[model samples]
Target: MWGGCWPAGPLRRSAFTRRLSVPISAPEALLTVRGLEAGYGKIGVLHGVDLHIAAGEVVTLLGPNGAGKTSLLRALSGLLPWSGGSARFGGLELRGVGPREAAQAGLVHVIEGHRVFTQISVTDNLLLAGYDLPRAERMARVEEALSFFPEIAAKRHEKGGALSGGQQQMLAVAQGLVRRPRLLMLDEPSAGLSPVLVDRVLNVVRELQARGTAVLLVEQLIEKALGAADRVYALAQGRIVLEAATSEADLPRRLERAYFGDDAVSPLEA
Candidate 1:
């Protein structure tokens, strides 16, 4: 996020990390997934999966492509039906739940593509997400979400499709924020973003955690993910292969070693 091109080495501490006085630690699970299995008909993506995200924590899911990271989010958000196991967000079980029900229950999934009402204005897009609320409360929520994404706030009157990709991505997150999620699941939130905008968006993730929203992130930017993660779970071939605290002395090394059986593969190379 500095002025120059992104550094080639592993991600270093940011000013955001230093600003916090206390370290975030693991808490009781706000979301609990056990033996989760999901896939298209006759195909399976998650295999006996087990994962948890504590209240107000940021947990990142990492892995190479086709590792079922997106599938995990989809399953949790109730976009895909589950074959076995349960995912509990607070007291509600996700199995058999619909996408709108999941969101209403405070489980918001901002999927990878940053889907929005392209033909509508940015403000209208956010308003659509809060349609269940009264107009007065809806406007308040919209304003609060805009505060987190000032770029979109500046273009509030423009069509959602007119914004650049990064701005649209921000608007997608802002839409989710208006829901005041108990657990926010993001799939590749930084994909295709410029380095600076990537930094900005990830900063919002960290900030959201500080403000008491638990986050479940699936990211390809391993270093950036680790830098902001409280705990991390790495998936490979549809199963969780590695789990560690972000504070581990050699996290990237251990993650790669767990994935490839070679300590030589730094996350920077991924």
Candidate 2:
């Protein structure tokens, strides 16, 4: 049984004032999934999937569209009700959990399309995301989140709707960060951004990981997501067909084959 993310105490007081060096120590899995199942409106989209993420690790979910990659993220984050599975993160089972409960447990999901409160100032959006925090700590985290995206720091007071597309995406991530999550799941974060901005956003992601925040990334940009992953899982036809360490030499070809052509491509290709 997993213990859930925290020890039932206040979050450890910490500040990400600057980019920290990537820790050399490898992390053990902090999230574990077995036989997970979830779907939309009674139609199942994820079928008996299993995956895991280690503390401070970057795990990427990849596959062609309609492969149910987003479904897995939603299921894990408690957005879609799931069935017949055990998803234990930091010692808590998540299958029947609600989104607010999940977030309070330190699993924060930044959904697809750069969702934000368009009418609110960037700072206000961040503040709202940190609503459960005490006043002083919430303000500190808002500043900390803003620090990661200096390009948008100057625009913190501006209405979210007024920022350019790329900036809003950055703000979406900052909103998630404001919650001080132990596991941050992002879906299609690079959508609608230039190559340069895409790189910029991913860099901040890497920085967050470096700062010891676990990340589960769902991305359509194959190369970019795989490049940042320490491990990768390919979801297809609502099932996981491949799982491999990012260091695997033949992973690119393997993923290309598993993701593109027909068939299981070897059940759970190691």
21 in model 1: Cα distance from truth in Å? 28
Model 2: what TM-score? Answer: 0.85
> What TM-score, computed on C-alpha atoms, does each candidate reach?
0.89, 0.85
Model 1 misplaced stretches (Cα beyond 4 Å): 1-26
lDDT of 1: 0.83
User: Per-residue CA lDDT of candidate 1, range 1-270, in tens?
Assistant: 322212233322231122111223346889888899999998988888888789998999987777788998998888898999988889998899999999999999999987999999999999999999999999999999999988999999999999999999999999999999988998888988998999999999989998999999888777788888888887766777667788877775766465555534465543
Error of 1 at 42 (Å): 0.4
Write candidate 2's Cα lDDT for 32-99 as tens digits: 88899888877989888877788999998876567787888888888888867898889788878989
Best by lDDT: 1
Q: Which runs of model 2 end up more than 4 angstroms from their true locations?
A: 1-27, 261-270
Q: Where's the lowest-lDDT run of ten residues in candidate 2?
A: 4-13
